[model samples]
Target: MAVNYPNGKKFLAESHMPKTTKKKDLIYSNRGMTLEEEINSSNEHYLSSGRAVIHKKPTPIQVVKVDYPKRSAAVIREAYYRQSSTTDYNGVYKGHYLDFEAKETKNKTSIPLSNFHEHQILHMKRCILQHGITFVLIRFSFFNRVFLLNSSYLIDFWEDTMNNGRKSIPLAFIEEKGIDVAYGFNPRLDYLDAVDKLLEHTNK
Candidate 1:
């Protein structure tokens, strides 16, 4: 007699069966978190604890069309990037304005300058000049490392790029000037540590 599966599929006696995921495996499989997920979670923790108020900026999109499937709901059918964003996040931390762009790179030796935009570089400079806490959070995904790269250092590199020079910032260069952001359970990026360090440097 042939065995028939519940889905109306017949199987031979020597047929290979599909592997089933165990309940334990399921729990562990769903445990890992993405960089964005971790960052957002940390932000929520900070907001609730009254440590700081930081939020990811919403990307403006030009919706060309929308489908009204129901009276109470509408689904965006077409959209386009409105314009370039200056930064990924902005907020007031410890009574000081903070602005930064978060980016991820896979390069092991250097972070390509192309990863950053001209407008963002300009915005960071303006923010710094205006006494805002401006920096970039760079996540070297391949190396599983994160760094708080100061706007000053980034600006210097940006200037060089405009001239005749390397188009990327070497990891060694970043290590020398940038502060390494330690990962933790809460405040995943824990960039405030670097910010505090920057504050000390500026004050001194």
Candidate 2:
């Protein structure tokens, strides 16, 4: 059984691939969880503690073919994405519509704006227009720092790039504009604390 993209390219799962290592790419840290894994842990804690209701958005896939090798098992032979996904996650928080994207960068100086897409920035803008709380959780993997940046800043930088402005968001600018999220035990990344501060200022 095989899965494919809409463009007729065969899709391979990362878990099924052979692992390779690069000495330059290695980071010395006791906390080895990826940004997405940490967020998932936080979401679970939030859900169980009645703090928030957020979940990762599943990509829509359309299965074109399947094979029943056994009476109890069916394997998908072909599939394609139904459409481009909007964001990484979305749900309700503190009686407000929450929509956000989580990204991790190993760069020590700046996070490249290319980490974001035009459609995603537009989607965040649309969410804001609906009076929803939309933002990005940026993890600077090199420094082990996390920042919760509001969507407006992300949208502005994206537009600036269209005019041949800076290609990356400076760490200094992020430290100034975005709220820092401290790492913790139970939830791992305490991003909701940053969101609470944002709500305190904007109340939107």
Candidate 3:
């Protein structure tokens, strides 16, 4: 389904940019796997191990033009996002619904709220209201820090912004409220550990 911002801005699912390209130069290099790629690999590990069933949602695209040079070969010349995506990833984990968005920022001190759109936040709010486990996996590539922040805190900051507050969340605030996820060899990003903590809190 197509989601839109309050101002009528349609969400574009296929929009994302990697924080860094060169690995050898940066101290916290992702080793060529962008945040999205690492998460995909982690999800694969989870699925294969029967740990979870999370999957990244495919961005729906509307093909504008196509060329057929040969009968067996077809090329997409032009296309655009068909609908605004709800979130980056979602699925079932231990019989509970899991929903989240993954983001990376080069800034070391703070993560801009602009990284999230209105509709995305709304979708998260809805998911939480419906008793789904929702959160955002944010990567601070420069500092080599990855955090799993709950959607409730995200919503609070979002509402604060709408009320004319800060436009970004400071790293200190995130560190205090978010769970630090360590990078690993097998699953890549070990965010599910953070999820366990989140569930623990929720159950309490």
TM-score of each: 0.80, 0.82, 0.81
Tens-place lDDT digits, model 2, residues 1-204: 474323322554655443322111134333467788778778988999999999988888999998655433456889998754588899999798999999999899889999998889888988888999999999999889999999899888889999999899989999999999998877778899999999998955
Off by over 4 Å in 2: 1-30, 81-83
Model 2 quality (TM-score): 0.82
Best candidate, lDDT: 3
Q: What is the C-alpha lDDT profile of model 1 across 1-204, one tens digit per residue? A: 574333423332323443232232245542455555556666877898898999887788899997655332355789998765578788998889999888788899999989888889888988888999998888788878888888888889889888977899999998989999998756666788788998888889
Q: What's the ranking of the predictions by lDDT, best on top?
A: 3, 2, 1
List candidate 1 segments past 4 Å from native: 1-32, 67-70
Error of 1 at 202 (Å): 1.2
How much lDDT does each candidate structure score? Answer: 0.78, 0.83, 0.85
Compare candidates 1 and 2 on TM-score and give the better one.
Answer: 2
Candidate of highest TM-score: 2
Candidate 3, residues 17-135: lDDT per residue as tens digits? 23232232155545656888788878888999999999999898999998665433355789998756599899998899999999999998999999999999989989988999999
